[model samples]
Every structure is written in C-alpha cells, then in structure tokens.
Target: MHLTDHDRAMRDGAEGDAIAAAMDLLIRYGEGLGAEVLCDVRNVAGTSTQPTPAKTIIAKEHGWDKAFSVINLDSDADIAIPPMRVPTCQLQQGFNDEVLSISPYRSELVELQDGAESFASEKGINILATCTPYQVGNLPTRGEHVAWMESSAVIYANSVLGARTNCEGTASTGSAGLTGRIPCWGNHREETRRGTHLIESDVRVESFLDWGMLGYFAGDVVGEQRPVLSGQLARPTLTDLKHLGAAMATSGGVEMFHLPGVTPEARTIEEAFGDTVPATTVHYTAADRAHVYETLNDQGSSTDVDFVLLGCPHASVEQMAEIARLLDGRKLHPDTRLWVMAPRALRDVADRNGVTAAIRAAGGQVLTDSCPAMSRTAPEGTRVFATDSAKQAHYLPAILDIEAWFGTTRDCIEAALTGRWKGELR
Candidate 1:
C-alpha cells in the first residue's frame, strides 16, 4: 500500500516511537481494508476504559504529549469510548481485578489519566464516560465525518444523525484521536450509506422495551446491512432510539439503520432506500416481539428475582421522571436491589426534577457514568435478574450465569416493587 507524506513522516518517527508504532499499526489496518487516504476525524469514540500494556507503552514511549496533541481539547462534548471489557458470564471471580493488577500501568484508566494530562497540557477535552456520547452533545451533524468506536453510537450517528463514520475498534479510535484520520468506508461513503434491508413492522411499540425487541429482531434478519424501517409506531424518543441501537448492535454487526420519519435519512420509506430496496422485506408482527423476549429470557420457570437494572444507553431525564412518577410513594422490595444508570447530565436533571429523590426513596440508586452490564458489578450469585434493556438481558447471562428476564420499564418497576420476575406469556 502506498503511504501519504504524513504517513511516511510518522513512519520516520516524526512523533517518536510510541506514536510511530501506533501509526504503523493503524496504517497497516487501513492498508488491510484498502483505504488509500485517511479521512480527517474531527471526533473519535472508543470502546475500552483502560488501556492495554501495548497501548500504554506506545503512549508513554511517544510521550503522550505528541501522541494525542492533534485532538481538539476545548470541546465540552463527550466522546463515546470503548468499554474496558466485553460483556461475559464466565464465573471467574475478580477477573477484571486480575487483569488490572497484572497490567496496572496499561488500561483505559491509565490511558484516560495520560490523555487527561496530555489534553490538559494542551487544551482540556471534556470526558463524559458512557457509550452514549451523542446524548451528551458529541453529535456529528448530517454528512459530517467522525470516528466512533462504540457500536451503538456508530449506528446512531450514521443512521439517525445522518453523520458519517465506520464501525471502529478501540485501537483505531485511539489512533484517530492521535492522528485525526480514519478510513472513509462504510457510512462515510454516499453509496454505502443507502439502506439495503427493508423492515416493515405491523406491531405497535409503546415502550422502550418494545424498541429494544424490534431492534433485536431487525438485527437478526438484517445482519450487517443498513435497514430502513417502515410502518406503524409513535415517534421514538432518544432513549427509545438508544435501546434500539444498542440491541441492534448486540444482535449483529449493524452500524447504521434508518427509521422512517424519525431518522434524518429516512423521512419517508422511499427516501431511506433511495427507491431501491431489497425485493424481500421482513415484516415484524406481535409474534416477533414475543419471540424477542422468549429468546432473551430463555425458557425458564424460576421467578425468584434478585436484581432489577434499568438504563442501557443510560436513562434520559424524561425516563427518569417516569420512574420517579411510578415510585413516588412506593418502596422497592427489601430483597430486590434496583439500580438505575444515567449520564451525569441526566442525573443532574433528575436531581433537579426530584426524580433522584423519588428513586432513592423507593430504594433505587441512580448511578452516573456507568451501567451495571458494562461494569460487571451485579451481585454475585444473582439467580434471577431483570432489566428493561434487551441488550443487557441478552449479554448478561453469558457473562454472569444469571437467569435474565426481559420486560418494559413498568415491568422492572413492578419487579422492584414486588421482588418477582413477571413471567412473559409465551
């Protein structure tokens, strides 16, 4: 592969060893993907919280200063970085601790520290720790280019926001931050941006859970192709779209999907497809929605619930308000531990709206910057767990060995209030 003058300079150690090595890896990856020129990446989202030894060593060797000096640090908008770990259910206690202990100096935490110092020495970039960076104003407007690592964020930005980006990995996003360049593939190209799969839903979705189920169903059928959704439903809120994006990403390698009348591209079904949809269109019915729940929960009779978690993309202020309204004078079951995850901004809004007080009064704690599914912090030996997020329920069992129940926010609220899994009708 031919290298640009800038790429050649990096190879010649213009930025020192660490950066040069990182750049070499990125160049190789770009070459592997047949990317001739790197697009300018104004914003970057990553997947891991801690840096690996290789990444840290590279950063340190390059003098973190020169490695990430190209990023715009004055922005208050948060960047969606990668999760430190993938969702897993292997019952290895203290797994993360072991990894961290062995590679203390290398991790997202260390990288974040290094990044903080590097950014501070230059300009301070806002760090909002969550997968839903777009929610906190890091959105790339229509046709604008960006580098995002989080799968859901990539899908949302590309499909919903009409912004352009490829589904990148943690290392690639980091490289983009350092060099401000990304391969212009996938959603970045106009030809690749058009919808390939046609999804027609006959069922009416009333809650965020419904959207999650729809996303899972669409992803299962659509695979990695961009799906253009059509047919009946209310306009989904940002929270609803978040669940949809997360569930879709979890189900498949989908990085972008358009919902007619909701997403920027799909103002109409025809617009989403540019009048050239696939001959076969998948129709989602009530049975399909039920199938989503059944597949996620697994066929189980155990109803003894121990944990109830909410917020996948993290709850928005409106959802928090709804939770507060539902639990205004109620208390969670003493045996059931209910946890709500929200972004720092929404958490503050919840506090101001008295939603935080209501949730706390009802024995639920609203945490900021992280979700239980992402953190792997659910109580050990949790036999029966419930959540409003299909993505959470789908991945949690494989990593935690817990029986998960999928339901709506109301269902979770009821579970918290009663401490029992509300069995879905098969």
Candidate 2:
C-alpha cells in the first residue's frame, strides 16, 4: 500500500502507540483489499458496537475504561484512545432494560451497555445509540466521505443522502474513529457508484411499504452492483426513503442506488449511467409486489399475532406522529403487544407532542436504543409476529423461530388492535 509521509510516520510510531496501532491496522486492511491509498473520513457513526465476550466476566475486577477497550476496541494497549477527529455518534445498543422484559440476563446486559455508553462518551463519542444518527445531528452532506457501521445507515447515506461510504465492520469503524482514515475502495470510488442495472416499477409508489417492495426487488436483482431505478416515484417522505433503503440493505448487499429525479446522483437517467446504457432492465408490477409480500409473510390467515413490531430503521418524528394519529382513539387487543422503537431524541420529541401518550394509551411501547436483530428474546409464548418493516419481517422469523408477517403500517396497527393479520397486497 502507498502511504503518505504522515501515514508512514504514524505506522512507524511517530504519532505514539495508539495512532501507530491504528495505522498499522489500516495498512494491513489496505494491503488485504488491494487498496493503494487511504482516504480521510469526516463523519462516523459506530460507537455502540458491542463485542461478544469469550467468557462471562463475573466481577468488576478491572476498571470500566479497561473493560470497554477489551470489549469494544479489541485491544488492551496501555495508551488512552483519542477522540474522533470528525463528527461521531453511536448506533443502537442491544436492548433497553427499562422497557424490555425478555432478556434473562437483563441486569447484566444493561450494565454492560451503560458502561459502553459512558466509556465512549468519555472518549468524545456522542452516545446517541440510535440507528438513525442523522435524525439526532450527524447529518453528512452529499459527496462527503464517512465511515459508517450500520448497514441501513450505510445504504441511506450512500443512496439517499449522496454521502460516500461502504458498509464497514465494527472493528474497522473503530479504527476509522481513531485515525480518521479508511481504504479508498468499494463505494469510496466514484466509478463504483454509477448505476449498472435499471429497474422500472409500474405500480404507483406512494407509501413506505410500496417503496420498500421496490427496493427489495431491485436490490435482490442487482446484488452488490449499483441499481438505477427508473420508476415513477412520487415525492416520497423521509420515512418512505428509510423503508426503501433499509429493506434494500436487508435483502441484498447494496451500498448505494440511484433513483432518477429523486436521489442526488441521478438527476437524469443519462446522469445515472453516464456514457454506458444500463446492462439490464428489471420491471416491477403489482404481481412483483404480491410475490414480495408472499415471500415476506409466510403465515396462515388466523387471529394469532403475538407481537407486532414497528420502526426497524428507527421511526422518524413524522412516522411516530402518524402512528399516534392511527392509535389515538383505538385500543390494542389484550392478547397483542405493540413495540415501537426509535431514537431517544425522536422519542423525546414525540413525548413533547403527545404522540408517546397516545401510543401508551393504546397499550403500545415507545422504546429506544434497541435492535431486535441483536436480541433473541421475545415475549413468552410468541409464535406469530407482524411488522411493517420489510427488514424486520425478513429476519425475525428465521432468527426467532416465529411466523413473521409483513404488511403496511396501517395493517400492523390494525393487527395490534384486533389481534389478526388482515393485510393484502393483492
């Protein structure tokens, strides 16, 4: 790998042990990936990554700082870790102890999460612990470079916000936070960001669910390549875009996509493809939507919804407001449980606007700083599950051994109210 004098100095230990360690790791990464240079990352969003312990640490014998380094940084170096050079925030943790009653080791897990938050904060990491860090304050501009860990956030930053980043791992992002550098490969290059496939949707995509199906279909077809969407998409809301990007990242390894006239890169179809015409064109109709719906929901039509989850990408303020509106005068069935998850900042905003109250009045929970993917715990006797997020529906069934069903947000609310799955894409 070719390194500038500064990088070489860092690798040679001129910048002390911590920076030297980081630079060494980066050089190894660059060599392993055939990258010739390292690029500076100005925005980072990966402080909440919890390393699985090899064995249980039964007692607090070591200090929290030391334990944090061992668990998060994967290093036990004596040097104190430096602050992030750029804007940085945490993604979601495992679960919130104040609300969740599922984890058997609830007390210990919460302690570990709290320790992680405090340690990262002391090292200048903004511990928001929400997947949607942009909702709080870490909004990166178009074309700006960043190092992000959350897959959904990576896709959103790359495809929707036009920021450049690849889906980074927890350890690599920690190195980026320390050294502010990453390998200039993959989506970091401008050439790889262009559309390689064209996707057309004949269905009118107005809601979040419709956009989600389009994204899932397009991403599966194109795989890791850039997909140029030539569909008639209305002016979608932020929630709609979130659903699309989240499901796209879920179903496929898509880092970025271009939607002509909607996303930043594709002002026109020609702009998306540059000189080359799209190598392949895919079409999505009502039949495609039905297929996606069937693939997502493989459950029987019965009155047996044990759990109904919302907000896989973490609900925005507008989504929360809409959910509140839907549940204003309604009551959930006694057998059903609704879990609404989002960033703490947005939850506070919803609380101020009486949205949280409306949800709680209807027996729904507004949880923060939790990712269902990380937690295998569910409500006791949970057999049938329903969710509005395509990402959640894609994973929960296989992970939790429950019958997961996908539907519209309205359909999920109706399921919560009546304890039934009455949604139809047909």
Candidate 3:
C-alpha cells in the first residue's frame, strides 16, 4: 500500500511508541481490507460505555478521549449513548479484572470524564462516545468526508445530512483521526450511494417507536444494502429519524437509506435511485407492520415485566418533556423498575424543564451517558424487560437472555403503571 510522508513517518516510529503502534495497526487493518488510502474524519461517534477493560483501554489509547471533548455542529455536545455494552455481569472464568481496573468506569460520575481528561493530559485524537454526533456539534457538512464509528451516525450522516462516511469501527475511526484519511469505500463513492432495494410503506406511523419499527422492517428486508423509501404516514421528527437510523443499523448493516422528501438526497423516487432501483418494489403495509411486531416480540406471553427502559439514542429534552407530560401524576407500578437514558446535556436541560422531576415523581430514574444496553445497568434478576425502542427490544433480550417486549411509548407507560403487559396496552 502507498503511504504519505506522515504515514511513513508514523510507521517508522518517528511519532513515538503509542502513535506508531496505532498507525501500524491501522496500516494492517487497511491492508487487510484493501484500503488504498486514508481520509480525514471531521467527527467521530462511538458507544459510550465499554464492557471489558481491554476495550476501554484500547479505545482510550487510540482517541476516545479526544473525540468527546469538542462540541460538534448543531451546537449541542456531540455525544450519544449506543446499545453496545453488556447489561450486567458477574465474576466469570476468563474475565480479566486486572485489565478492567485500568480505568475506573464510575470513578467520576460525569459524561466523558475519564476519556476527556485522559485526552487532555495525553494529547490523543478527539473522540466523543456519543451515537448522535451530528446533533451534538460534530455536524459534517454535505459532501464533507468523515470517519464515524457509530452505525446510526454513519447512516444519518451519509443519507440524511449528505455527508460521506463508511460504517467503520471504533479502532479504525480513531486511526483515521491520527492519519487524517479513510479508505474510499462504502458511502464515499457516488455509484455506491444509489438504492439497490426499493421500499414503499403504507403504514401510518404516528410515534417515534413506530418509525423505529419501520426502520427495522426496511433493514430486515434490505439487509446490508441501501434502500429507497417511498410512501409514508406522519411527518418524522429528528428524534424519530434517530430511532429509524439506529433501528436500521441494528437490524442490518445498513449504512445509508433514502427516504423520499425526508433525506436530503432523495427528494423523489426518481431522485433516490436515479433510475437504477430494482424492478420490484417491496410494499410495507399495515399488515407488514404487524408482521414486524410479531417478529420482534417473539417472546411468549409474560404478564410480569421486571424492567422498563426508555431513550435509545439518548432522548432529547423535548422527548423527555413529552414523556413527562404523559406520565404526570401517574405512578409506575411498585413491581416495575423504570429507567430513562439520555445525553448529559439533555438530561440537565430536562432537569431544568422539570421533565426529570416529573419522570422521577412517576417512579423513573433518569441516567446520563449510558443506556440499558450500553451500560448494562438493568435491575438484577430481570427476566422480563420492555422498551419503547424496537431496536432495544429486539437486541437486548438475545444479548442478556431476558424476555424482551416492544411497544409504543404510551403502551410502555401503561405497562409501567400497571406492572403488567396486558389490557388495552397489550
């Protein structure tokens, strides 16, 4: 593979041991993938909490600390909580406690505290462990190249924002920051951006959760390819889009999708495909939506729900406010444990807006910098769990061996109130 002067210098160990090791690993990764050259990454977003100490230590050594320190575009801190970490763990064989002790996971109860501090002191690359980097300030302009690690962010940036990026992993993304280049693959090319699968939805999705389900449906059908979406129901908000992107990322390896009139590139069906869509278009009707529900909610009937989780992609202040409004004066059932996860800044805003207070009064705990899937902070002995996010409900159970259920936010609130999954809500 060809290398620039800087790349050669780094490879030759002129930059010092840590950077040199990182570059060598990057070169090997690039070579393995047949990446010819590297591209500069304008922003990076990754999973907030890591499970093992080895992963966290490696992330920190590369650039996780530096990425979270700066504000991305949209003026909000570009931080997001993704569903990547184990929910809970016990002492097990082959687990390395000594490695885990390298970084105190909760030594300081603040977002990006250890990573940010380490970045400042050690002078590593910038890396914010948020899923929604575009919202927080790492907004990459249209056509601007970036190397983002988060799956949803990759799709959102490339499809919605018209920025270019590959669905790169955390380590490669960190290396891109140091080398200032990424291999021109995936969404970086124009021809690769066209939709291979066509999706037409007739379901009337009114809630963020519904959009998430739609995304899951699209992804499950389309698999790892881009899909062009036509037809719709209600207008989607940013929060809804976030859920859609995340669900798509989880359901499949979809790095980009075109929603007619919604995504920047796809104003119309013709525009989305440029006349290259497959002859057959898959129609997702209300029945199809029901199919999605049935497929995702595979767990058998379980009246008792031990845990309830809200806020995948970290709820925005506005979303929290809406939750608070729906939950005012309503108490969560004593048998149910409720948790709300969001970005630290948004959590603070929700507190000031009394959304946090309302949720707490309704028997919910508001946590920042992590989600149930990312932090693995669910109630002990939680055999049955429910979430408003379809992506969470679909993936968490398989990972944690718990029975997971998907429902509307209203339905979730009703379950929390009743401590059971039944009645009109079910």
Candidate 4:
C-alpha cells in the first residue's frame, strides 16, 4: 500500500499506539484489496457499539469502551483511541427503544444499545442512528469522499449524490473514524463508476413501491454490474430513490446505478457511460414487475394482516407526515400492530410537528433509531405481515418465516385498520 510521510510515520508508531493500530489495520485492509494508495475521507459511517452475535460477550459484560474497541476496532489491546477526527455517524441500532415496555424484546439488548450510544457519544461519533444519513445533518456533497457502511446509503452516495465510497463495512470503516482515510479502490475510482449494462424500462414508476419493483427487477437483471437506465421513467422523489436503492441493494449486489438526466453523476446517457456504450442491455416491461411481485409477496393471497411495518431504511420526516395524514381520524385494528421507524433526528422533528402524536392517537406508533429488518422482535404470534416497502416485503418473509405482502402506503394503512390485505400499487 502507498503511504505518505505522515502515514508512514503513523505506521512506524510515531502517532501513539491507538493511531498506529488504526493505521496498521487500514494498511492490511488496503493490501488485501491490492490497493496501490489511500485517499482522504471527510466523512464516515460505521457499526454502533451495539452487541452482535459475533462480538465477544465478555467485553460487553465488562464495560462500554472495551466492548467498542473489541467490536469496532477489531483490536482487543487496551489502547485509548482518540475522538473521531472526521465527521462520523452511526447506522441504525438493532431494535426500537421506544417499544421497550410495550414489546416483549429483551431488556439486555436495550441496555446494550444504551451503552453503545454512550460509547459513540464519547468517541465524537454523531450517533445519527440512520441508514439514510444524508436525510439528517450528515449530507456529503458531490465529489466528496466518504466512508459509509450502510448498503443503501453507500449506493445513494455514489449513484445519486455523486459522492465517492466503496461500501465500507463495520470493521473497515472503524479506521476511517480514527485516520480519516480508506483504500482507494472500487467505486472510489472514476473509471469504475461508469455504467456497464444498459436497462430500458417502458413501464412508468408511480410510487415508492413501483420504484422498488423497478429496482428489484433491475438488480436481478444486472447482478453486480453498474447499469445505466434509459427509459420512459417518471420523475421520482427522494423517498422513491431511497426505496429503490434499498431494494436494489437487498435483491442484488448492486453498489451503484446510473439514471441519465436523473442522478447527479449521470447528466446524460453518454456521461453515464463515459462516452462508452454499455456491454449489455436489458429491457423491462410491466409484466416483469408482476412476476417480481408474485415472487416477493409470500402471503399467498391470505388477507389477514397481523403486523404492518412501514420503514426499512428508516422513515423520513416527510414520510411520517404522509403517514400521520393518512391515520388522522382512523385507528388501527386492535389485533394488528403498526410500527413505523425513523431516525432520531427526524422523529424529534416529527414529534414537534405533531406527526408522531397523530399516529399514536390513531393506535399506530412512530418508532425511532431502529428497524425490524435487522431485528425481529415482533409481538407474540405475528404470522402475517404487510409492508409498504418492497425491500421489507422481499426479505421479511424469509427472515421472520412468516407470510408477508407488499402494497402501497394507503393499502398498508387500510390493511392495518381492517386486518385484511388488498394488494394495491398506489
């Protein structure tokens, strides 16, 4: 790996044990990737200090700092790591702390989450527990280099915002918090950002679900290759893009995608591919989306909806506003549980705007800092689930081993109120 003078100094332990450790970790990681050099990263997102199955239970039982060093830094050495040098944030925690008393979730996990938050706060990581960090105060502008871990956020940063990131993970990004550097490779390279496949869709995308359907189909068609989309696509909102990126990451290993005249990086088709035509092209129709819906929805036509989950990448304040508007005068069915998770920052704004209040008053909850995708703490006997997100509907059935259905926001809200599912796209 290529190291500058200061990097070499740090490597030689000139910067103390903590920085040396961080530098050593980064060098090994860069070497593993056959990277020739390292680049400066201004921003970073990484794993919370929350306990995971792979983390040592002893460190968790000991204290927060030890647990953080063990889980995040990949080093058990008792070195006092410095505060985060670059702007750093956290991905969402495992479960919603708001439902501690209401749900049957283990108390230990909540306590661990609290410990993790405390640890992160002390380390100068802006504990913005969210998958969509750009929605909050951690927005990275075009051409900026960031070390983000969340799959959806990474793709959005590279594809939509024109930022550079290579999908850094928990252990790898931990070093970014310390050194503000990462291996210069993969999506961080300008040549690799060009599209490899061309996808043309004739069907118009209407809502977030439709966008997600298109993304799911696109992911299946383009596997790990970057695709340039040129089609009769409708103008989509931020929510639509978020859902599409999330579903794309879930259904396939798509690190980035380009839509000419849509995403910042792709102002034109020629620009999207760097003036080189894609090696392959795939065409999609409305019938292809129908087939994906049939494959993703596992409820098998059963209407009895027992659980309704709205947020997978965490709901935005705008989404909460829409949800509050829908449940203004209506109450959820007594037998059904509706959970809508959002970032803590957005949740606070939602609370101040009376958006969370409206949902709570209508028997639905606006949760914060957690999503059910990572943790399945559903109430007793929730066999049938319905969600507005195609991402959740695609994975929840396999993760929870329950019947799951996908529908629009209105359809999901209606199902929550009536305990019956009516699949509607919009």
Candidate 5:
C-alpha cells in the first residue's frame, strides 16, 4: 500500500506513539484487504468502552491505556492515548444500571462500563451508546465515507443513507477513529456497490412486519451479497427501513442492499445493476413470506410468553409513539415483562413527550444502550419470549437458548398484556 506524506509522518511518530500505532494498523489492514489506498473518513461508530472479559482482564493487568492500545489499536506499545482525530461514537454494549432490578445481568459489569465510559468520554469519544448512530445526531451525509461497526447500522448507512462503509469491527474502527482513514475497498468503491441479486416481490410489502419478512427472505436468498428489490413495494418510513435492515443483517451477513427507486444510489433497476446484469433473479411470493414467518417462529412451542422485547436496532421515535399508543390503557400480564429498547437520546424524547409515561403506565419499561441479545440476559426464568423485531426473534433464541415468537408490534403488545402468544400471520 502507498501512504501519503501525512500518513508516513503519522507512522513515523510525528503525531505521537499512539497515533503511530494507529497508522501502522491502518496500513496493515488496508494492505491485508488488498486495498491500494486509504480514504479519509470523518464519521466512525465503534465499541471501545464496552466491558468484556478480555478488556477487563487486560485493564487489570495493564491500565486502561494499555488495554486500549492492545485491544483497540492492536498495538502492544506503552503509550498515552489522545482524543479521537475524527468524530466517533460508541455502539451498543452491556445494560445500564436502571434495569438492574429487572434484568439478570451483573451490577459489577455496569460499574466497569461506567469507568470505561469515563475514560472514553475523556478521550473525546461521544457516548452515543446505541446501535443506530444515525438515529441520534450522527447522520452521515449521502455518499460520505464512514467506518461503522454494527451490522444493522452498516446496512443502514450503506443502503438507506447511501453512505459508504463495510461491516467494520472493533480494531478497524478504532484505527479509523484515531487516523480518520479507512481502506477504500468493498462498499467504498463505486464499482463494487452494484447489485448482485435481483429480488422481485409479488406480495405487497407495506407494513413494518411485511418489510422485515421481505428483508429476512432477501438476506437468506442473497447471503453476503447485495440485493435489488423491484416490484410490489410501498413507501417505507425510517422505522420500517430500520427493521428491514436489522432483520437482513441478522438472518444473513448482508451489509448493503438497493431498493432501486427508493435508495439514493439507484434511480432505476438498470442503475441498481450497473453495467453488469444481475447474477440471479429471485421471486419473493406470499408463500416465501409465510415460510420466513414460520422460520422465525420455529423455536417457540409454548403459547405463554414470559417476556416481550420491542426493539433490536433500537426503537425510533415513531416506533415509540406507536408502542405507546398500543399499550395506552392496557397493563401487562402478571407473568410477563415488557421492555422497549431505544437510544438514550430518543428515550429522552419519549420521556418529555409522555410516550415513556404512557408505556410505563402500561407496566412497560423503555430502556436504552443495550438489549437482551447484547447483554446475554433476559428476565429471570424467561423460557419463552415474544418480540416484534425479526432481528431479535432470529437472534435471541440462539443466543439465550430461549424460544421466540415473531409477529407484529400489536401482536407482541397483545402477548405482553395477555401473556399468551396468539400471533399468527395475517
């Protein structure tokens, strides 16, 4: 890989030892990916403050700075860390203290995360502790290059917002945060962004549930490759698209997709395919949708739901309002617990607007920063769970060894109220 004079200077320790290590990692990462050049990036989403066993052990052996140097920067050198060079934010991690009484997660982990947060904040990393950074205030401009870590967020950035990013990991995003540079490969290049598979929907994908089912089907059919959707679609809001992307990322390793007329990069089907023709054309019919629905619910056997989770990629304000409306006058069943995961910023919006109060009145808690899947904890003895998020339904069963039922938000709310899973595909 070729480095500019500035890159060379950074690698030669002109900026500092920490930055030099960061530059060295970027160079090696770029070259390892067969990338010839590195492009400048201003926006980055990472998980440097998340408390893990590895991070804890390293921090115990060698202070937080060395922990960051080894875990984040991929360097063993002892050097002082500096403020982020570019704008960066932390992603979803362990549960916060507010839900300790309800969740089975440990309190010590939360304390460790609090200390990690302090260290990260002092290093100029914004604690936008949600999977969806675009939801808060970190919306990247169209066609902007960014290094984001979350799979759902990566899909959203690449497809919905037209920003360029691969499904980045901890170390690469750490390097990007300090250097403001990432490899100009994968989704960053225009040629590689073209659609690989074409999916035509025969069933009208209008509702949030329908969109999520379509995304799950698309991901399974296309697998790590990009898909272009053509027919039988409705105008999707941010929340609907958010669910779609998150579901796709969960079922498969889909980082980017194109809705042709809807997404920014493609104005037509031809543009979505670029100069090359699509490799395959897949038809998504009503039967396929039903199959996806069944697949998402295959883990469940009991009709009695012990828990209901509303968000996987974090709930948007619109979703919060809808959830609030559904549970306005209803209280949860005595045996069931309901929690709506959201970004802290949007949780504040719900709090001020009485949305949170409405849900609370219904005995549902709207928590932020983490979910059951990330925290690896659900309500104690949660044998069977129900959720509106296809992503959560697809993941939590395998992660927690619990059963899940996937359905509409209304169906989930009904389960939360009645403690029974009466959800069937409508």
Candidate 6:
C-alpha cells in the first residue's frame, strides 16, 4: 500500500507513540484489505467506552490509557493517549444507570460505563452514545469519506447520504479517529460502488413495515453485494429508510444499497448499474414479503408478550412523537413492559415536546445511550418479546434465547397494552 508523506511521518513516530501505533494498525489493515492507498477522512464513529471483560482487566492492571492501547489501537506498547485528531463520536454501549433497578443488568457495569464515558469525553470524543449518528449532529456530506463502525449507520451513510465507507470494525475506526485516514478500498472506489443486483418489488412497499420486509428480502437475495431497487415503492421518509437499512444489515451483510430515484448516488436504474449488468434480478412479490415476515416471526410461539422493544438503531424524534400518539389514552398491561430506545439528544427534544411525558404516563419509557442487545440484558423474566424493528426481531431471539414477534409500531404498542401478540402481516 502507498502512503502519503503525512502518513509516513505518523508511522515513523513523529506524532508520538499512540499516533504511530494507530498508523501502524491502519497500514496493516489497508494491506490486509489489498487497498492501494489510504484516503483522508474527517468523520469517524466508533466504539470506545463499551465495557468488556478484557477492557476491564486491562484498565485494572495498566490504566485506561493502556486499555485504549491494547483494545482500540491493537498495540501492546504503553503510550500516552492524545485527544482525537479528527471529529469522532462514541457509539452505543452498555446500559446507563437509570435502568438498573428495573433491569437485571449489573450495577458495576453501569458504573464502569459511566467512568468510561468520562474518559472518552476527556479525550475529545463526542459521546453520541447512539447507533444512528446521522440523525444527531454528524451528518456527512455526499461523497464524503468516513469511517463508521455500526452496520446500520454504514449502510445509511453509503446508500442514503452518498458518503463512502465500509462496515468498519472497532480497531479500524479507532485508528481512523486519530489519524483521519482509512484504507481506500471497497466502497471508497467509484467503480466498485455500482450495483451488483437488481431487486424489483412487485408488492406495494409504502409503509415502514413493508420497507423493512423488502429490505430483508433484498439482503437475503444478495448477501454482501449492492442492490438497486425499483418498481412499486413509496417515497419513504427518514424513519422508513432507517428501518429498511437496519433490517437489511441485520439479516445479511449488506453495506450499501440504491433505491434509484430515492437515494443520492443514483438518479436512475441505469446509473445504479453503471456499465455492468446486474448479476441477478430478483422480484420481491407479496409471497417474498410474507416469507420475510414469517422468518422474522418464526421464533415466537407464545402469545403472552412480556416485552416490546422499539428502536434497534435508535428512534428519531418523529418516531418518538408517533409512539406518544399511539399510547395517548392507553395504559400498558401490568404484565408487559415497553421501552423506546433513542439518542439522548433526541430524547431531550422528545421531553421538550411532551412526547416522553405522554409515553411515561402510559407506562412506557423512552431510554437513551444503550439498548438490550448491546447490554445483553432486558426486563426481568422476559421470555417473549415483540418489536417493530426488523433488526431487533432478527437478533434478540438469538441474543437472549427469547421469542420475538415482528409487526408495526401500532402492533407492538398493542402488545404492550394487552400483553398478547395479536399482530399479523397486513
């Protein structure tokens, strides 16, 4: 791989030991990916504060700087960590302290996370603490190069915003945050960004649920390759596209997709494919949509729902307001619980808008910073769960050994109210 003068200087230890270590990792990573050169990036979203047993051990024995050395930089050397060189934000981590009494999560872990947040903030890392950073303040422009770790965010960046990035990992993003450079491979190149598959949906995909089902079907049909979507589709909102992208990334390793007229990269189907013909053309009909829905709901067999989790990638302000409206005059069942996960910034907006108050009055809570899947904990004695998010429905069952029912927002709210899974594919 070729490196510029600045990159070479960093690797030669001119910028201090920590930055040298980060450059070393980036060079190795770029070589492993067979990239020819390194690209400059100003935006980076990654995980740093999440508490793990390994990080805990490292911090206890060697201090937080040493923990960052071994975990974030993949280096064993003892070096003084510096403030991030570029714009960087921390991603979703363990649950906060507020949920400890109601949840089975360890209080020690929450305290550990609180300390971790302080450390990251001191290092100049913005503690966004949510998967969906674009919805917050870090909206990357079209054609902007970024290093983002979350799968859903990666897809949204490449597909929705036209920003270029691969589905980065913890270490790569860590390095990129310090050096502002990433391997120019995969989605970074213009030619490789073209679509590899064409999915024409014959079924009417207008609702949030329909888009999610279609995204799941597209991911299953074309695993890691990009897909260009056309045919019966509605002009989706930000929330709808968020659901679609999250669902696709959950079901398969989809990093990027194109909705042709909807997305930014491609204005037409022809442009999406470029000079290359689509490798496969799959038609997403009603039967295909039903199959995806059934697959999402397959884990659930019990009707007595104990938990209804919303926001796999964290909820937007619109989704929060919608939930408040759904639970306006209703109260949750005594046996069931509902939690709406969102970013703290957006949660503040919801609080100011009376959205949080309305949901709280109806026995629901809008929590922020972390989710059950990240923390690996849920409400006590939750054997069955229902969610409006396709990603959560696809993951929670395997993560928690629980049953999941996938449906619309109203369906999930109804389950929270009546303690039953009466939701069906509509």
lDDT of 3 by residue, 282-322 (tens): 99887888787887788737978878888877777887887
The runs of at least 3 residues in candidate 1 whose Cα sits more than 4 Å from the true structure, single-residue gaps closed, are: 1-3, 51-125, 275-279, 423-426
**For residues 36-66, could you state the per-residue lDDT of candidate 5 as single tens digits?**
9999999999998888898888887888888
Those runs of model 5 whose alpha carbons end farther than 4 Å from true positions after fitting are none
Residue 261, candidate 2: Cα error in Å is: 1.8
Backbone clash total for model 2 is 0
- Show model 3 residue runs off by greater than 4 Å: 47-51, 55-129, 423-426
lDDT of 4 by residue, 1-426 (tens): 779998989778887777777788889999999999999998999886645754537445666656656666677877776788888888877664668765777777777777777778888888887888888877788888889998889888888888999888787788888888899999888888899998898877766778888888888888887888878788888898898888888788888999887778889888899967789888878789788788777554678998899977889889989988888788999999999988888889999999999999989877777676676767567889888787788777777788898878888898899999887543
How well does each candidate superpose onto the true structure, as a TM-score? 0.82, 0.94, 0.82, 0.96, 0.98, 0.99
Compare candidates 4 and 5 on TM-score and give the better one: 5
Ranking of candidates on TM-score, top first: 6, 5, 4, 2, 1, 3
Residue pairs with backbone atoms closer than 3 Å in model 5 (clashes): none
By summed lDDT, the worst window of 10 consecutive residues in model 5 runs over 58-67
Instruction: Give each model's whole-structure lDDT.
Output: 0.69, 0.80, 0.67, 0.82, 0.92, 0.92
Whole-structure CA lDDT of model 5:
0.92
Q: Would you give me the overall lDDT of model 2?
A: 0.80
For candidate 4, the 10 contiguous residues with the lowest summed lDDT are 50-59
Tens digit of per-residue lDDT, candidate 6, span 259-328: 9887787999999989989998889988898899899989999999999999878999999899999998
* Model 1 TM-score, all chains together: 0.82
